[model samples]
Target: MGQAFLPGIRYDKMGEALFCHGEHVEEPSQIRPALERAFKSAEEGKPAVVNVMVDPTLTNLGAISMAYAVLFGHVPYRDLTKYGKAMRRSFLGFAFPGFEKYGIPDAPWPDGWEPIPPEMWER
Candidate 1:
């Protein structure tokens, strides 16, 4: 199968909507200006869409906290290992079907990462 490419942004308005074009705005450097303009319009209660071209090399850290919450839903400290095993199986096992023995590498934290305190997870 051929590699998929990003589609070109369409500029056509079906009816009464105004369409603003950001020509050749397909780089990480071009995102901030587009966001600024979109936010300004949103603040003023105007309909706006910021069509940004995402660079794959950039780690999309935008939803890190939310994604973490979803993946490990309020897991208690005592059940960390259990939840961790489930997550590992769900993500890695399915990727390598029938390779149950494929080991997932240890996390790359040199000094070890701090665990979220148990008190925080009690709620």
Candidate 2:
């Protein structure tokens, strides 16, 4: 979770593959938004990194497009939401039993923040 994959570099820290720009993603669909996002943050002078604790299968990719949100001023969040919905449906159809089936870990809600289960994740 502490490791960050910046745009335009490649590194590995603590079993996580950190990828930057110019690196090819095996699953472009998953990491594309984050790639774009990290670059946008750099361009907009907000240069930042998104620290995520996600499944090792995601590698450089995480659950949401946090990087892309920074890049396009978050205009893509709406689309990302839709994309997530569709993906959930696909997962349900395949009976993936949610991300827990993937052995993915979820971050605990911080003291000041609460976790709200998305309506769609429900049966």
Candidate 3:
């Protein structure tokens, strides 16, 4: 089999109206500045395209595996009701505990229901 190579394009030569077509900003804190710059350029008749780095939990395996564990005998389940409640919380709790900070409210569980602990993430 022959090797394959991808050709790269020079977006800079596209002129001011298409400025920053392939720009990258590494840090989350840098996103605001990058967006501001892009907006300013666009306001001045030059629109920019930026690719910002983000951690989207792309590799976190939780949902299906957890549900499976609960369904089978790998994990203990004394009370189906309580187990279901924790499983419900596990969907977001295990993967997105910090979601509340992003303005998306945490998943609401029944009152007095114990939340799935962080230890769940370990498995």
Candidate achieving the largest lDDT: 3
Write the residue-wise lDDT of candidate 1 on 1-123 in tens digits: 011123564332311156432233467887788677666866776656655555332222322233443456455423444323333344434455543454444322111133322232221
Which stretches of candidate 2 lie above 4 Å from their native place?
A: 1-28, 56-123
Candidate 1 segments exceeding 4 Å error: 1-5, 9-24, 57-123
Error of 1 at 103 (Å): 18
Model 2 residue 45 distance off true place after TM-score fit, in angstroms? 1.0
List the global CA lDDT of all models.
0.40, 0.38, 0.45
CA error at residue 85 for candidate 2, angstroms = 42
TM-score of each: 0.33, 0.21, 0.32
Model 1 deviation from the true structure expressed as Cα RMSD, one decimal place: 13.1
Better of 2 and 3 by TM-score: 3
Task: Order candidates by lDDT, high to low.
Answer: 3, 1, 2
The 10 consecutive residues of candidate 2 with the worst lDDT sum are 108-117
Tell me the tens digit of each residue's lDDT in model 3 across 1-123.
010111343333343344444456668888888788878877887668776544322212333344543454333333223333344444535565554565533444332234334333232
